[model samples]
Structure formats: C-alpha cells, structure tokens
Target: MVTLAEVAEHAGVSASTVSYVLSGKRSISTRTRERVERSIEQLGYHPNAGARALASSRSNVIALMMPLRTDMYVPVMMEIAIAVATSARAHGYDVLLLTGDEGPAAVRRVAGSGLADAMILMDVELDDERLPLLRDSARPAVLIGLPSDTAGLTCVDLDFVATGALCVEHLAGLGHRDIAVIGEAPAVYERHTGFAERTLEGLRGRARDLGVRLLHRPCDPGYGPTSATLARVFDERPGTTGFVVQNESAVEPLLGLLRQQGRAVPEDVSVIAVCPDQVALQASVRLTSVSIPAEEMGRRAVERIVAKLAGDDADDVTLIAPELTVRASTGNAPG
Candidate 1:
C-alpha cells in the first residue's frame, strides 16, 4: 500500500503537512494543497482511516436521525436524506442513518461511542425526547425542524409559519373569502410536530386578519380519508371557494375529487399547495404553491453540523424563507 510518507516524499512535503491538507485542520497554501493532491493521486496513496481518526480525534462521520413513521410524506423525507448524504460526501464525511424507531437511545449510542463526529435530526417535535439528550451530550448536533423551545439548539428548517401565511395571502388576494385548509394526518398534529402546527397557526392567524372564513381539517393521506375530509369541509362551509393544502399525498386526490365534483379550478374555486416544486409541476393541475425546500434544508443542516464540529458555535435557529411559485391551479376566486 502506498503510504502517506511516500506521497509526502513525492510532493516534497512532510507527512504532517499532508495530514493538515486532508483534515483541513490548518490552512495549507493553494499551491501546496494542489501539489499534495497530485502526489496522492499519482502515488495511489490512500490514508488509513484508523490513523486519521486517531490523529484528528474525529470519526469523520455524521449521523442523521429520521422518523420511521409511515404517516409522514415519504418522498420528501427521502429527498432530504439523499441530499444530506450527498452534501456530507462533498464535505469529506459519511452519513449514518438511524431511524426514529431507535428513539433517544440512538442518540446516546452514536454520541457515546464516538462513531460519528456530529448529528443532524429530522422530524423534530415541539418537545422532542431527544432534545434533552442532545443538549447534554458533547457531540455537536443540528435539527432539521423547529422545537417548542429552541434554547441552545442548532436548527435549520423552512419557516413554516410564513409558508402557511403566504398560501393564505395568495388565496385571499384572489378574492377567496371562504377558504379551507387540508392539513397533515391527525397523528401528526397529535404528536405536535412543530412544522404542521406552526403552519396551521400562521394560516389561521392570517385568515382572521384577511376576513376570510377558514376551515381546517386534519386528514390521512389517501383517496378515502381525503374524500371524507373534503365532504366535511364543504358541508361545514358550503361557500368555500379557496383551499390551502399542506399534505402532499392529498394534493392529487383533492384535484381529482374537485374535477369529479364538476368544480372548475380557479374558475370556480382556487387552490394553493404547500409542497416541493416537483409536486406542483407534476400535479394534474399545475398548483400555485409554496415550496418546502427540502433539499436546501438538508444541505444547510449538514453545513451547520459541519461548522459546529469545526469549533463554530451554531446554537441558533435558521429558518429558510418560503417561496411561492405561480402556476395553473390558482386564479381569481369565482363569484
């Protein structure tokens, strides 16, 4: 095996210099770094992982804790996970995915074992059980969602409150007075998932300010539950002419049901969605939507954790602003 010493000899630099370049622990001139890299490539030198860890006191791995629940939107979660892994690789680290099934013990195991340098947690609840453990642990960590109390925690997520308000504002501007909101699963609300409740709070508060009559219903994501929820919504407020749907799974089913019920979108009732841009573009009716920025959130979370591991204090919350894209599903509310 070609060793670091051989690469250092080829590059005319010391082995410690080569180590500094690889670990980014100290500044190496661009010219020197380039020379070291070239020497490493030409010599087919691969650093021993165990030696590197011993020298750096870092495992060079990041743990990502994701929810195992089936009720959450799986596609968006998958996208975030993929983004985290990809971004971690770009930063010269690997990812360890731990499902929520392991609960707070997973946090302890990873932090205690020194198996990972840091952690990024997803699907955070308002009062998550893992928060206390994370706060007490020495390992640096970042959260992908907000919590009820953000004291001493590093968090990165979309501003769901603003996202919800943006959806309501768009509909109300289109003269949609009687509006309905299709929210996430009942279990999600019951669990007090921070984003879902925050979104609802923003929507409701803005609707009241806009003088729009708003009705909200928590729904399971599928045809049957959505159909039932839609029926109840219209039954409670028959004059409803606007909808703000936060559930991705219900988006298509809602559109299909509206068509089946003979309601012309935008011409009769306008709809706005909270989802990824891909979902909006591919929907049966192109939806005027506020995007979740899942990939961006994931990338930012990893960046924060990386910073934390590099001795930067990252204890504040980072909320990405919501962006709404105009598309086919929304128009002037019908008379």
Candidate 2:
C-alpha cells in the first residue's frame, strides 16, 4: 500500500498537504490538487476508510459571522465573503453565513446548537466581545482579523501596522513632511474595528518617529463628505502636501477635489492609498498604494480552521506582509 508520505513526496508537497487533499479538509490550489491526485493515481493510493467515515459524522459546515455595517466598504467585505465561501466549498464544506452583530450570542448559538463544525469570524475588534466564548468553546474557530489578545485564538490578517508605516515612509521619503490620512467613516473608528485602529496606530507612531505631521480625518462616503473632510484637512494644515488615504470611497473624490482646486498631482501634492489593487489601478490617478490581501486573508482563515480540525498544530497568529506599489499619483514634494 502506498503511504501518505510517499504520495506527498511524489507530489512535491508536505505529508499534511497530501492528507488535506485526500480528506478535502483544506483549500488547495487547482494545480496542486490535480498534481496530488495524479500522484495518488500513479501510486494507487487509497485514503483511510475509517478516518473518512469518522469525519463524516459531523455537520461539515462552517459558520461565518459578518455584520454588514453602513460604515464599511461593502465590496471588499463581499469579496472576502465570496473568497471564504469558495475556499470552504473547495474543502468539501458548506458555509453558513451569520451576518448579524449578535456578538457572543452568535458564538454561543453556533457552539451549543452544533450548527457547524467550526466558525470563522470577520470584522473583528481589538477587544472582541465574542473572544471569551470562542476561546472557551469546544469548536474550532478562526478569525480573519487580529485582536488585541490571542492567548488561545487563531488569526490571519494583513500587517496593517506595517502597511500604515509603509505608506507614510513612501511619502516622507519623497520629501512630503506634512501628510494627511483620510480615514474610514466615523462609525468604523468609533467601533474600534481592528484594521482601522491598527492603521491609525501605525500611522501616528511612525509619524512621531519620522518627525512628520500627520492629519487624520474620518470621512463618510460620498462626494460631499469627502469634500468637507478635504477642506478641513487644508484648513487645519494648509501645508499638507502629501496624503495617505485609507477609505476606499474617498480615494477618487479626494483626487477629483484636488484637481478641481488647480493642484496638479505630484506637482503640487502627492497621494498614496491603502486599498485593493483594482481600486489603486482604477483611480483617476493610478494610485500609489499598499494592496489589501483580502482573498489571502479569507484563504488563510479556512486553512487554519481545517488544520485545527485535522489535529495539526497551527500558529496562533498569521500576519500577511504588506507591499507598497508606487504608481503615478505620488512624487517629490514641491519646494
């Protein structure tokens, strides 16, 4: 009989990867899955019948808790949800979306009712209200965002702190000292959402280190609100020549507003953003930005949950590194 380790070696992957492929317990790339299946065929490998039967005894579903809030950018959230759903399906599991802000009640409900074998939480707070229940629950759970505490939790997310500092570093390196951070909506910051909070923390901390002035204004979605925020940024610091925008909705509007004020991009002012690649590319100005790895976050969350189910030792914290792409929107500061 061909062993799992032999099959893994044949497929050029780890033994756990071969097991995950056979068990359908984790999301594997189509190419890798195909290669593994081919290796299994060549080796006449058969998965353990007893283990498959035991795995089938559970609900085989994963619950995703995501609260749809007005302050959030829905497209990015939906993109992540779709990624999670797709990845879960690839692992031979169905997804049950719990899109309500039920807090710990949802955690308790899912765990107590045996509704799902595992859970993946989104829109996490630094001090999430549901962490206590999740930590104590017998079920496996994964968080797509980091929290302040991770004593007994598995989390996967972008390193927003590095992202913030990277954005500032890019602008400051170009000689733009007074920078403005047009951030997410007031409600997002008020809620202390993990991503927003971390980005602000990194931006402020790095500004202090670099001896640069950072102006952060939380702006609502829409042209009027963005315009208002921009006016205030200039009002407070008329010398603001560089921008680090975190809000997806405000990117284009800020650019348009700046253009309307007879300011040529990179000539009079520079703009950099923290957003998805498509957003950065599609902007009126091809935005210099740090791409948010939403799909990667969703994918890693599923892998962690599946690894836990497979009784493998998974890391408690997984942070994807951020990379900044410089494009046409930013340039040397004016004298």
Candidate 3:
C-alpha cells in the first residue's frame, strides 16, 4: 500500500505539511496544495481512520440517521448521501449512514461508542421520539427536518408553509378555483409529521380566501395504494381542475394512475407537485412543481454538523426555499 510518507516525499514536502494540507488546519498555497494532491493521487495513499481518530480524539465520522425502508425512494437517498459525502470530504471528514431500522439501539450505539464525532438526523418529525435521546447523546447533533424546538441543536429545513401557499397562489393565478391536494398522510402517529402537513395547511388557508375548492387526500407511499388513492381522489373530486402533489415518493404512482384513468396531462387536468425534478422526470411526467434541493440540504446539514463537531456553534436553523419549475405537465384548465 502506498503511504503518506511516499506522497510527502514525492511532493517535496514534509509529512506534517501533507497532514496539514489534508486536515486544512493551515492554508497552503494553491500550487503546493495541488502538488500534494497530485502526489496523493499518484501514491493512492489512504489515511488510517482508526489511527487518526485515536490521535486527534475526533473520529472525523459524521453519523447520518435516515428512515429505513426497502421501498424508500432511492434517488432522494442518493442525493442526500452524495451531498453529505462530498461536503464532509471537502472538510476531511467521512459520513456513516445509519438507517431508522437501527432504532434507539443504533442511536445509543453510535453516540455512546464514540464511533462518530457528530450526527445529522434526517426525516425528523414535529413530535419526534428520538429528539430526547439525541439531545441527551454524548455527541453534538443537527436535524435535517423541523422539530418542535430549535432551542439547543442545529437544524436545516425547508419552509413548507411558504411552499404550500406558493402552490395555491400559482394555481390560482392560472385561474383554477377548484384544486385537490395529494399528500403523504394525515398527522396521526409519529408517521405523519413533517413539512408535508405544514405545506398542506398553508395551501388550504390560501385556497380558502381565493374561493378555490381544495380537496386534500393522502396517498400511500406504495404503488398500489397510491394509484388507488389517486383514482379515488379523481372520482370524488370531479370538480377539481388542478392537482398539487406534495409527496415526491408517490408522484410516479400518481402519474401512472392518471394515465390509467385516461386523464391527459394539463389538457384534461393540470398537475403540479412538490418534489425534485429528477423524480418528476423519472416518472416520465414533466411536472410544474416545487423543487426541493435534497442534495444541497444534505450537504448543508453535514457542513453544520462538522462545524459543531469542531467546537464551532451551529446554533441557527437554516431553511432553504422551494423553487418552482414549470414543465410540460401543466397547462390551462379544461373548459
């Protein structure tokens, strides 16, 4: 195996200089940095994570907790993973992804074992049961979703309230008075608490004042359930001229159901969704929808986590806005 000493010798620099370049404790000139990087690439010298952690008391590993489901949206997860990995690598850190299936045991294992210096918790709920555990953990942590309180930990989330209102305002401007909201689920258990319901509330409030008839329906994350749910939504809300889908995971199933029902996109009914573009495109439906920067959110969350790990304050909550991307899926309401 190629060693750091080989890279340092090749780069005409001391081993400590190479370490400094790797750690970013001191800034090296671009020219020297490039030489070191080239040497590292040539030697393929990988740092010893265990040894590094033992020396610095920082594992340089940030734990990412996500909801585990075999049927979970792969693209969304990929985006988050890429962002977290990229952002952490830039700061000389690594990411360890831990799924929800691991549960409280996983939380205790990661926190108590000191395997990670910090953590970034994703898919948080308004009334998250894990919050108490995370708060009491030995490591510092940040949440990627909005929780009830932001008093102590760092958080990053989107403004779902504004997102909901924007969806209504956009449809209303298009002269649609009757619309239907398709979401993940209603807030019942810990299952349905996040930006989805908040956004729905925002949309409903705005739609009411505009005399827009809004029918909110929940679509199951699965294909069969979502298709069946959307079909029911269409049949029950016949007066609905437009549809706004807040759940990205169910967008594909919704599109499939629309096709099965012989509903032409934007021609017979207008469609808008709150999801990423890749998801919209993957469904082969060019949708006019609110785009969430999932990757960017992951990256920012890791950056904040790393900062907090480094004795820096990540006290503030960062909220990214949704960007509306109009595409072929939307058009004027049918007469």
Candidate 4:
C-alpha cells in the first residue's frame, strides 16, 4: 500500500504537510490541498487507521448502537444510519454501526481498542446499562433516546406524550367518541419501551375530559399484525368507532384486516397512526398520522454530538415534536 510519504513526495510536499492537510490540523492553501488529494488518488494512498489514531489521539470514527432487527425499528434505524453517516462525513468523521445486544461490551471494545473517537447510542431504556458505561468511558457519546435519569448525558428524542395527546385531540375535534388504540406491547423485560403507552395515557387523559372512553389494545410488538391480538381487541371493545395505531410494523396488516372485516376508513372507522410519514403514505388508503421525524431526529443527534465534541455547550436533552399530517382517513364519527 502506498504511504502518505509517497503521496507527499509525488505531490512535491513534505509528509508533515500532507498529514496536516488530511487532518485539517493547519489550513493549507486550497491549491496545495487539491494537489495532495490528486496524488493520493493516483498513488492509491490510504491513511493507516492505527497510525492516524496514534498521531492525533482521536479516531475519526463514530459508533452507532441500535438493535439490528427487522421487526421493531428497521425504518427508524435506516433513517438514523443515513443521517448519522451523512452528517459525520460532512464533519470529516465516519460511522461504525453497532447493535443493542452488544451493550456495554460494544462500547468497551470500541473505545478501549481505539476503534472510534465517540459513540451515538439509540433505543435507550429508562435504565440502560450502556448509560453508565458510556458516561464512564473516555469517549464522548450521545443518546438518541433519553433515560429516566438524564443527569449528565446528552440526549435527543421525540415527545411521545405530546404526540399521543395530539392524535386524540385531532380526532376529538372531528366529533369521534368511541375510539380504539393500538400500541406497542407493554415492555416486559426492564425495557424502556413506554413511548406508545405514555402517549396512550395522554390520549386517555384527554378523552376523559372530552367525555369519551378510549379503548386500548397493545400488540405483541412485531413487524406484522397478530390475528389473535386483533381479535381480542375487537371482542373486548365492540363499540370502538375509530382507531389510533402506534406500531408502524403492524400498520399495514391492521389496515388490511380492518378492510377484510368490511370496515370503511373515515366513513365507518376513522384512523390515525403514530408512524413515519413514509409508512402512512404507502397504506392502501392515505392515513392521517403523527409523523415521527425519524431522519431529522437522527441528524440532530449527530449534530449535537459533533457540537459537544467541538467544545460547544450542548443541551442535556433535546425533544422533537411529531408533526401531524391530516388526511382522508380521519373524519367525524359515523351516524
């Protein structure tokens, strides 16, 4: 492999100048930088990751930790991955995608082994083990989800309670009374999975004020609808005239099942979902939903981390509001 020395020699510049130009340690004229870059391309000179880390005492790489599963978070994960990669590249950094199953072991391995300069964590729970490890780790890190204890870490997330209340308020204004809510299953294994449930709480609280009862059904937290779960919902709450679905994974299947049961959206069963706009758009019928700004959230998380890295005072927590997109799927309760 061609070294920086060969590229520098070919470009007629010293190795130190080439290093400075590549690291942006000291600004070289644009002309010289361009010449070095061209020489690097011609000679196929790739910077040594280990040597670079040792010389600079920093890795130009960031680790993104999430669950790499297909069911709960594929869409959201894709959004964060794209945004984080793009933003990191713009700032002269690269990303290392990691999964939740690896936990603190991932952080320890990456930072302790000089794999990355920093980390971005996702899908955090109320009491995530990674939080403490990250806090104590020498590397700077940011979280895409907030923990119950937000004492020192920087976090970025959506205001799910507000999102839920907004959905209920939107439907209530259209004169819907009896409503059915489909949400993620209550977290069973010490998971911080209350985004949907907390939103339902807000909706139910508002529903009480409006003199209406909100019927809730929690799905099994999968990528598709479970007939057994849906049947239990309908059986227990037969009077539901509208629906609020929280799981994007189950959105299509639930809609299909609803159609199979001869239910007409808006006219017979008004619907609203807490999902990304892309998912809502692909539905057989357009759905009115509280669109989660998945990409924006991810981008913002990276921005916050970069800012902190640059010695800027970053906010301890940043909450993004879900945007409501009104469509044909929601309307007045049937006569």
All candidates: CA RMSD in angstroms?
2.7, 8.5, 4.3, 2.6
Cα lDDT over the full model 2: 0.89
lDDT of 3 at 181: 83
- What are the per-residue Cα lDDT tens digits for candidate 3 across 130-246? 778877776888888787677776788777887888888888888887898877654322365667667877898899878888988876567877877777876887777788987
lDDT of each: 0.92, 0.89, 0.80, 0.81
| Model 2 RMSD in angstroms | 8.5
Q: What TM-score do all the candidates reach, one by one?
A: 0.91, 0.83, 0.81, 0.89
Residues 233-264 of candidate 4: C-alpha lDDT, one tens digit per residue:
77877777778888776777777777888988
Give the winner by lDDT: 2 or 3. Answer: 2
Which whole-number lDDT from 0 to 100 does residue 92 have in model 3? 76
Best by lDDT: 1
Q: After superposition, how far is residue 222 of candidate 3 from its true place, in Å?
A: 5.0
Candidate 3 stretches greater than 4 Å from native: 1-47, 70-72, 185-190, 256-262, 282-284
Q: Identify the runs in model 2 with alpha carbons over 4 angstroms from their true place.
A: 1-56, 313-315
Q: Which is the better candidate, 1 or 2, if ranked by lDDT?
A: 1
In model 1, the runs with Cα more than 4 Å from the true position are 1-43
